[model samples]
Target: MRLRNATIAAASAVALVLAVPTSANAATGDFLYKVGPGIPAGLADPASGECINLFGATEANPAFAPENFTSSTATVFLDFDCDGDVFYVMNPGKRLGDRLKLRSVVFS
Candidate 1:
């Protein structure tokens, strides 16, 4: 009986460890951009290796003047869902002009 109880406890501990959620692999800083003539907005500590569509992006009003302050490089796209041709590649601590508009982005 004692051996069985010890084994059960060990199995429960292993299961608990496996059930624990892991932290996301996110960039350590913000990614700033502008939409139309509005003030600057950005994502704080955005997740890495995922496509992030701009909140208010469209053909008439696209996101522009991107500034990457994260630890990872940022790849911006002209189409939604990070599809279409690559608009530009912004490295960490880099900024771009308004001429570079985008609809989605991903951090690597």
Candidate 2:
């Protein structure tokens, strides 16, 4: 019947509209970087996830402090050219590489 065909066509249109996928903020276990013993690292935006690389860049202008033997403690920084990887300053002069430890990473 004409009415039956029309009803079926309407239902199909509605189903097609509902079937279209929409973007959603979902948690997936697919993308992750395991650093340290058992660490979970991932991006807030999973769609733009990719490999993160860190490169150590020599300081163009290193410390200009005069060389002297004094019993003084100070913090030193190990400069790095972060290609895409995150950096955390857990301690002074700490550089990340194979099996390096990390304290914490905060993203705002």
Best by lDDT: 1
lDDT (10s digit) by residue, model 1, range 55-92: 87887888999999999999999999999866788899
In candidate 1, position 36 carries an lDDT of: 73
List the lowest-lDDT window of 10 residues for candidate 1: 34-43
| Pairs of residues clashing in candidate 2 | none
Model 1 CA lDDT for position 84? 86
lDDT of candidates 1 onward, in order = 0.91, 0.32
Q: In model 2, where is the ten-residue run with the lowest total lDDT?
A: 64-73
What tens-digit string does per-residue lDDT give for candidate 2 at 1-108?
A: 999999999999999999998755332222223333344343333222222221211234222111111122112122332222533322312233434322222211
**Which parts of model 1 have CA positions greater than 4 angstroms off?**
1-23
- Any idea how many clashes model 1 has? 0
Error of 1 at 62 (Å): 0.7
- Model 2 compared with the native: what TM-score? 0.27
